[model samples]
Target: MTSSPLSPTETLASARRTLRTEISALQALDDRLDASFHSAVQKILSCQGKVVVTGIGKSGHIGRKIAATLASTGTPAFFMHGVEAIHGDLGMLTAQDVVMAISYSGAAQELMTVLSVCKRMAIPIIAITGHPGSELAANADIHLNVHVDHEACPLNLAPTASTTATMALGDAIAVACLEARGFQAEDFALSHPGGALGRRLLTHVRDVMRSGEALPVVRESTPIPQALQEMSRKGMGMTIVINETRAPVGIFTDGDLRRLISREGDIRQLTVADGMSHNPKHVSANALAVEAATLMDTNHLTQVVVVDDHGLLIGALHMHDLMAAKVI
Candidate 1:
């Protein structure tokens, strides 16, 4: 049988209707939140082993994403296909593990098979399902109801709003468990060392800063020509001016050099102290590279001096250092 195509107006109207339905479903899910949500979080937090997320078909797809999110956010988790569990994959489970079973109907035969094993092993089960009275939910230690009045699908047959609600609930549980465990950004960075956020959270000023001879430094009263040589040797386009005790008192940059030349300031008569900007921005050696980047941007600087607690210049870092380190 041939079907008629929708007009442009009809197509737009249908799309709007779907969005509205899903939004309404999410609002309903939000309103229905109560003690069970908290119970689910507490159960996962109390588990000593990994969270094993299991489901079949579309639910399985959502379960995999939920498991990934949980694992990435400090909760140890993995996705186990519900059917795979019954077919010898159940060996992955331990008494300490928590089973997060997903099923819109809460009556999947494959899930039912694993639920028994979970029970026998004394493993806690958190059920994410639309039907609270179904066998899976009835047997679960905590039931997270993801019920929706209707799916975003025009026929109301596809898992649309229901899956969205389920995924949102799963995220809520993961974040709650993360906070309860006192999971910090540095801890998260450890698991995601290759990502930009990992670099920002894990990298310190000392890790990326230029120290020793690589740091361009000049005594306070050094001649401008000598400081220029130091900057050229270090190739940082800048140099720190230090006092008698080796404490940074000022900074001179390539920009300052250009301005001095433009103003016809006598380069031969100038000292590093006369050419430098007093009390330049600096950061602690232990400060985050990202924080250093922020200070650089805020101060309109390309480089900043790294100092120790005693206010002695320990190192310096150019903005390029942070960019190369992927801290910015």
Candidate 2:
């Protein structure tokens, strides 16, 4: 007797087999990484001018993304489409620059044409491809191989595995270069100051803090009623209860006043020190506003006093100040 086509279990087994093959293919490509990767990293770091990543089709799209990541991380970079290089755009290529050329097979006609022009210009070239023997790899100043044994697609035609390897390899090169140059978060922030992460990283407490007469401060012996008036006039929702030196002795807020009400204590007899919280949380003028935000968030507070190392109060900041500065 002949057996019928198997059940759902058999179909699932086929799918698992495909997934395992693709995952292994990606892992195999990763394990194959070697010295050529370091060579590529050196070429990028030694580059005096911008990194220009060029490729045709899908590789071109990935090239643009790689360039963006490099630029944002402190290595200057831009993308030149491979096909456009053969047109009038080859003029953008300069001898001072290093070129990163991407091709899966390493034989794309447009890439070959651009590589030839790069040779004539004496610009050093780095090649990324699956085939080591391809013409594109032969002319490289440094060569990086992104070989993978199989495609994730069942038909073995789509670019999933190859592109993944290429992208992974590009990221490896970028990070290696970033580490060599000691690229820092502040450096990244300068490249992206208009973005939220940039603002969060670059903005300092001095840039967003309220200083001078805007500071809500009262001496330690001041009457509670007058200190309440000072808090009201400052509009920061709190007062820096201070000493004779204008250093913060404590703090009083609407929170303190709310706790004041319904108590049998006499409002007229209460000294500012009686209602003040001693040694209130404060930040320095040079500190990051984001740090101030963290201080407020961690302490369940709405404001913080800004002081110098000597304990003299120099500034005050409220949570809304952070919101307005986009520090939150």
Each model's backbone clash number = 0, 0
lDDT tens per residue, model 1, 140-220:
998989999999998889999999888888888888888998999888998898898788888999999999979898887
- Residue 163 of model 2, lDDT score: 82
Kindly provide the TM-score of model 1 when superposed on the true structure, using C-alpha atoms.
Answer: 0.88
What is the per-residue lDDT of model 2 for residues 204-261, given as tens digits with 9 covering 90 to 100?
9999999888888888788888888888888998888877787888999888877775
- lDDT for model 1 comes to 0.91
All candidates' lDDT scores?
A: 0.91, 0.86
Model 1 clash pairs are none
Off by over 4 Å in 2: 1-21, 259-264, 297-300, 323-326
